[model samples]
Target: MAGRAGDRAPKARRIRLGNREVVTEGLELSFWADISHRCMTASWPAFIGGAALVFIVFNGFFALLYWFGDQPISNVPRGAYIDYLYFSIETLSTAGYGDMHPQSHYGHFIAAVELFTGIFSMSLMTGLIFARFSRPSARLLFADNPVISTHEGRQTLMIRLANERHNIIANATAQLWVFKSGVSKEGVPYRRFYDLPLIRSQSPALALSWTVFHVIDEASPLHGLDAAGLKAANVGLGLMVSGYDDVAAQTVHARKSYEHDQIRFGHRYVEILRVTEDGLRIDYSRFHETVEG
Candidate 1:
């Protein structure tokens, strides 16, 4: 009689063919990868590598023992190394169900070391997992306040900046990077970005308007930039800001990102520098689903 395919011991699960480990499937893999990355985040790689090497060494040693029919070399009923390996692993993992117990002194010693290693390694892994999950994802939104403003008795293409988080990240210092694009004698677009000097850094608590004075004077390249030209000319703004937290002595967490679509220009001009002043602030929590621009 021929055996069914399911009874074929040689034909194992398909996962064995791939870079997949049976134990590290599904949620386990996700959890382990995150933990591994975090553990190795600032030198987490070395530790994880070492752990892998140790695991390999122990696994290979036991497999060889099982193949060779080695004994416990004591008054212990030495089972095959395969039994020792399985029993050791179970004991080390603290799943002591008493299905198999060490009968020899040599077997007992091996079990002790494995149990110790398991406890230490598991505690370390757990710490890494906690830190990784506790850490927040860093993402932020910042848009230049206004393009045109009243400066030195002239309507200038000024850029203003401020922190958006109302109650979060107090005393956050903000920096602005501006990129201006224009065509030279060849009429091809030329671009340059510069860090703007702020009188006082961005602190959410300040509630002060920080202005980047781009003097669009007669001699300035920005002077001839009409509404359409200004749009066509293309100017980009970037902000990088950080602040010290006295309470935490370290920043609890932080997030920042640059986006241009947030800067909106309407055909109707409101003579206001700050969006909050003009009641045009962005809520950012929800979308209206129908945005004109």
Candidate 2:
């Protein structure tokens, strides 16, 4: 059997964002061309390990250069690569320990180049650390699954999210979108996107839980879609939330995605908020709980 048209395309990479892994094809970029981006996105352990490896490789290269030179340093030990490596470390770090001093012009030149490289690398590392620390991130928690049930005499779709940081988010806004695979009039296969209008998509101050709702009426894009229908069409849903974080003093955004099977129909979220004698209390333990409507 012949393979699909997309299978014949040159595959480039798979990138994961939110809950989707997008398959990109027909193009690729050189690693050096995007080194900065790669570094910024790398995990802390991986970044530190890579930096350490580079440091060792550079010091080893300089140590080899010193070993080939004739009596470049005044160290007592002769023909010792370990001693030369120690000297390279001291020079690269600019420690200038008087015990081992460069006595030849070749040694001085190598020391000078290593010193400059060390200074430049330290400055670059400092900048990268500062950038990573200053990057704004959202601590928003989303429910594992969305629910569909009757609300105010209409069938509705609902998604729940909370501010896990417990900080005020001013002028918070939300958007919901759906993707579905279909064939156009000309019989061309395509994936189409549609926006689902929500009843209340904005919150003046979101510090706790918020549930956005969308009535699945005749005008809605998901008006008549059932579980089987959604599965057959390969439907996917995405939710995006953004707001100005009062504590961080910057705009932060969060997003999540749901596959067709993750939607729970004929169900509603369990109550988590109650009025106590002191004030109001929320039971986060029940936040993700849902029951049949």
Candidate 3:
């Protein structure tokens, strides 16, 4: 029912980092080798369904063993496969009803093994569930596109992000890096990374939204580079933000990447902060919207 690696389906995976798609093949990963990682990353429904399937298969396997034995169970009718299956379920779950039980020595040995397996599996499942729920995660929302426009009489590249949780992130720090592909003087191809300096990279407490600005001056790596020039050079950008979350009591980090084509030249983000009758409000509906400058 399964094909070899060379048959047709090669071991390949397509991973999306930012807007870039990278294809990797020939990685022979064993499912059992990374079972814990796979289970932890799996969706709620998938994880639960897989656990249920395993439980059923385990009981079914023991049921066949009980069916082969001579008078394995007392209350089960002779030649009734379903009754043996039901008895197997009861024994494996440790829900032994007095009505059905092991009668022969062979049945007793199988039931003993099933009881041990039931206890071990239930403990493992409990640990996995606890680990999944205790994992730390961030709720940072990044704008879809980075905009370039004039700010403070200089061309500026701006990226906006918000705290979806509306909780304080203390000592939040941000970094921006630009990636460019070029040929070395020795005629070798290479991709280089350059840090882009932001106007203000640190915040005492980030509660709502923050806009980071990188002025493209003569000293800047992005200076004299238009959208077309960036694309020609195969330029890309990555942003990283990290801080201690007061609510979660842990350090959380978020990252976003933008390809050259996703960069918007001569554009600015729509204003989202406004004064309301009650108080100052931030309209996040237009957070990702930009207008031509």
- Each prediction's TM-score versus the true structure: 0.44, 0.91, 0.88
| Better candidate by lDDT, 1 or 3 | 3
Lowest lDDT 10-mer window, candidate 2? 2-11
lDDT by residue (tens digit), candidate 1, 1-293: 77786763342333321122343222223445575564545455676686677666765564354334345423224545556666555665678767566555665666677678778877976787677555543233333234454545665543443334333455666565655776788887787866655445555542333334445466555456555655565655555645544433445433232323334332112223436757765443321111221
**Which 10 consecutive residues of model 1 have the lowest summed lDDT?**
284-293
- Give the Cα error of residue 182 in candidate 3, in Å: 1.9
> Candidate 2: misplaced stretches above 4 Å?
1-12
The TM-score leader among the candidates is 2
List the candidate 3 regions with Cα displacement exceeding 4 Å: 1-10
Q: Arrange candidates by lDDT, descending.
A: 3, 2, 1
Residue 167 Cα positional deviation in candidate 3, in Å, after optimal superposition = 1.8
Q: How high a TM-score does candidate 2 get? A: 0.91
Candidate 2 vs 3: which has more TM-score? 2
